[model samples]
Structure formats: C-alpha cells, structure tokens
Target: MLHVISQDLSSFNTLGLRSNASALVRYEHAGQLPALSQLAQTYKKVFVLGGGSNVVLAPDLSALVVKVESRGVRLVAESSDAWLVEAQAGENWHEFVGSCVDKGWLGLENLALIPGTVGAAPVQNIGAYGVELEQRIQSVTAWNLQECRLVEMNAEACRFSYRDSFFKHEPMGRWLITAVRFRLPKAWKAVLGYPDLRQHAILAAAGENATARQVFDAVCEIRRRKLPDPAVLGNAGSFFKNPVVSPARYEALHKAHEQLVAYPQDNGDYKLAAGWLIDQAGWKGRRMGPVGVHDRQALVLVNHGGATAQDIAQLAQTIRVDVAARFDVVLEQEPVAIA
Candidate 1:
C-alpha cells in the first residue's frame, strides 16, 4: 500500500473540489488487501475513493481514505446465451464499455460515456440512455473490511433499484470492490427508447438495425453535446435523481403542466424528469456564488470555479426546496457527499 499524509485530492474528484485527506492509502492489487484491512481496523473511520466522479468531498476529511486502483480485464465465462466479462474496480467505466462494444460483446452501448470506475457502477446502479448497470451486472467481488476477507455477491444479492444498490447502503469503506463481472448477450438489439436517442441523427439513419457500435457512438455524441466535460467545467453529470411518482401524483403534475416530461416505470410509477422540474422552476443557468446549475442541462450542477462542497450542497438544497415548493415533488441528490 502506498501511503501519503495530507494528501491533496483536488484532481481525485470530477467536481474538482479542492480537498485534502489526513491520510490516503492507494493499493493496486488484491494482495495488498490484508494490510489494508489491518489499517481499516485501526482507523476509527475509513472512506473509499474511486474515480471520484460521483462524489462531493469536504475541504478536509479526518478519516483514512483508501484509493482502490486495481486494474485488469478479461473474459471469464461464455455460453450460448451470454459472455461473462470481468473488469477490475479501477478500470475506466467508459473505456470498458467501449472495449466490450469493440469486441462485439453487445448490451452496454446505451451506457456509453458514463464517468467513474467499474467498482462505482454497482454502487450507483449507473444508468444512461435506456440502460442501467444493474441490467448487465453478473456479480461483484469486494474485500470486506469487517470480515477481513474477500466476498462475492450475485446480481440479485446486490439488491439493485434505480440508481442504488446494496453497496450504497453499506457503511462507507465497509467493502472495497475489487472487480465486477458483466453478462453481455451475443444477440443484441438497439435501445433507442429515449426521445434523445430516437431523434438522434446517428440512430435515426441506422433505423431499427442499429449496431452496438452505432448506439455507443450515438450515446457518446449525445452526452458530449448535453453534458459539460468535468475537465473543462467541473460537474458531476446529473446532480439529481429523477423522482419516481405514483400514477395519481403523475396525473396531478401532468394536469398542472402539460409539458411535464416523464417516463413510465414497469411498477406502474412515473419517473419525472428532474431536469425539466429544475428548468421549469427557473434555475437553469442560475448561479449562486462559485457554483451554478449548468445552463445547457439543468440536471447538472457545476462548479464555476474554486467552489466548495458546502457551496454545492447549499445550492442543491435551495434547488430542491424550490422544486418541492413549485411542483410538490421532492428532488433527491445523486452524488454522495463525504465530509
């Protein structure tokens, strides 16, 4: 394990928040888990830092921060129905999806350009376009800090539910995901259900016979056009989760505003577009000090420059309150904050 005291974490998070951890331990291999477990036992509190894409970090963290940097990818299993591929926790998520598509292992094309690491995918149940990571995940392997051993959990055991899973509920640092297994089907179909995907020129040209690579390219292009790059303008993609409402609630909202953008869920609920809500609430392009809602995409809250986590939190709270008051629906933040 490589240890550093007063580690600077400005570049660690996609939000580009200037933060520091009292100590940071980075391990690149599973063989270092035993030592990491010992340190976890010694510390009063521990936090796992991944690609730093989907997080809001405090200026100073007083806990031990473990940076999981393990890396590897391989074809683990295959059958007539599907191919099981494994990726280490630290692997770049977008790159992994691209690789799978390149190798003709289709199914993850709709999730192209998602930020963060492979290990972080299951934690957030990361989804985009028309696909969620849970739909493709086969299993997850992690080092259990409390147990001081490795553990594996199948997809069902992960308890995935819209933008959440068992990993999110567990105490921070309780489990350090080492790798993830994905089941990609040999027979693939394009998922252009979303209006953006359906209307996109690339997919529109391909019609019903769009290939996985085309879908991947379309998703990437759409994302680039909609979302601001973290490198150019620091932001964690979508700042809030789409609020799912009952049919009655959806009806009320629809009656109130005919232009409300929403999608029906399999469980007879309606997932309201958080971006539409925020935009209608008159927060788009609005700024509060150094942080503001991205002008192009209301769902994104960007750090204008030199913004603190507190600033982002306050702005998010204000937006939530305004949205709740305006629409009588609550907006939940997607990024996990660490203080």
Candidate 2:
C-alpha cells in the first residue's frame, strides 16, 4: 500500500504549489480499499486524486488526499477484430494508451498524450482529436463507498456528456473507481472528423491514405508543439471546455460576429471554440502575478511561478466576465476547483 506522513504536498500535485494535507493516503492496490475508506470516517477533509491534471486548489488543501494508485490490467476477452481489456485506476493514462498502441490496439490512438489516469478518464469522458473515451469503454468497475461493495457501471450509467459524467455530477464524491474496461478493435479505423486532424493525416499521407497509428502520431505531435509540458510548465491542460450553445443562439452570434467558428452538434446545437473566443478578446499571454493564460491556447490558464490557488481563480474570473460581456456567452472552466 502507498503511504504518506508528510504535512506538505508540493511535489505530489502537478501545479507545483506548496500546500499541506492533514494527512495523505496513497493506495497502491485495490486491496487497500478498506484502509483507504476508513480514513473518510476519521477525517472531514478528503478527496480522491489522479495525475492532478484538472484541478485548481483554493489553498494547499488542508484535507486528507486519498491518492488512489491501484494499478494493473487484465484481458477478459479477445477475437480477431476486438479485445476486451480492463485497466486498474492508477495506470497513467498516456502510458496506458501507449501500451495499447504497442499491442496494436486501434481505438485509443486518437486520444494519445492526455494527462491523468485511466480511473479518472471515465469521470470526464475524456476526449481529443475527434475521439472520446466513452466510445471504447465497455464498463467501469468501481468501489461504491456508500454501498461498500464493488459494482459494474456501464457506459449509459456513466452519463457522459461533453467533458462530464455521472461521477462529475450526481454521486459526486461517493464512489472511487478501481478499474476501467475497454473494448478495442484490432483493425485500424482512423477518425478524421476533426478538420485539423484530417488535414494533418492527409498532408502526411500525400493524399494517399493514413492509418490509425499515423493519426495518433500526428495528434501527439500537434499537442506537443501547441501545449506546454505540464511537468515543465504547470498547467491542467485546457482550462475551459468548449461551450455548447443552442443553434439559434449560435446563429445570432454568427450574425453578430462573422468570424466565429462553431461546430454543429447532433442535438441541433453548436459547440463554440472557447480558445478562439479568448484569443480574440486578447487574453492569451496576458499575465497577472505568477499565473496567466497560455500563449498558444488561451483556454489553458497557466501557473508560471509561486501562484496560489486564488491566483488561478482571479484570472479565470476576469476571463469569464470579459468573454461574457463581449460575446454574451458564458464560459465554463473544464478544470475541477477544489475550494
């Protein structure tokens, strides 16, 4: 089992801020379930953490952080075309994708290089480069702290939406996911729906053809060049999710702002590009104290130096208010705020 007796948690989080925890518990395996669960009874402040990819703290949280590190994978079924595989929660997400790629699995190629762990993937229904994790998810096995038993939750039960899931809404901090099961295909089928990805794949193939592996490689290259490395430059990826707006509202905005780029959703709505909007408003590379919006993608607010959690919040508020006033649209942050 994982153990932590230190009062400070500066190194543990990706944000690189010095904060204290009353106590920190790390679970290296699922077998440590009872011990980890027992802490909730003894402590008032408790939270589950993954790779620290999508969170901003109000302060070095004074809670007991249960760092779930259950790690492993097992293949439950396989055929010529597809394989059913289950991965433990703590497995680093991109590394897990890399393993599947090395094994010639085609489904996860489009989601390469996303931060966080497998267990946390389903919570946000993490997506990228025209693919979402929900497409490959078969079911998730979680330890329901309320019921004190293991339960298998299917995709529908997960309630996935654009960057949201059941765990993100209802039953919010109740169940801790232990493992995730995915049904991956052996045959490559590249999803080139996203314009930039398609263009990249086409350019790379010289108008011939690009496979899933090629698409994955191209997407990784794009992300690496566009986004700063979190390990080197503290960030939580995209700080704001692309906002989904109704079609009529989109039309009005389009008429008002002709240059606005939006994607029409199946539900007769539109998903506006938050990054473009932020950049248009001139927030990119703007700094206040040690935190600011990323120079490349304004949606990604970054921490440059000794930025407290409140520093991140203040910058976000300014962006939100300005964007709302200028465009008449509300921008919602993608990262989890632990205040």
Best by TM-score: 1
Count clashing residue pairs per candidate.
0, 0
For model 1, the stretches where C-alpha displacement exceeds 4 angstroms are none
The residue pairs that clash in candidate 2, if any, are: none
Kindly list the per-residue Cα lDDT of model 2 for residues 1-339, writing each as its tens digit: 446564565555676654667667887876777766666666665678888787776565666687877789778899988999999999999889888877766689889999999999999899987788898999998886545678899999988888999898854447889999999987666777887785774544644466656776788888998998888988888888899999899999999999998998888999999999999999999999999888887878888988888888899999999999999989998888774
Give the alpha-carbon lDDT of every model. 0.92, 0.82
| TM-score against native, each model | 0.98, 0.95
In candidate 1, how many Å is residue 16 off?
A: 0.8
For candidate 1, the 10 contiguous residues with the lowest summed lDDT are 1-10
Error of 1 at 72 (Å): 0.6
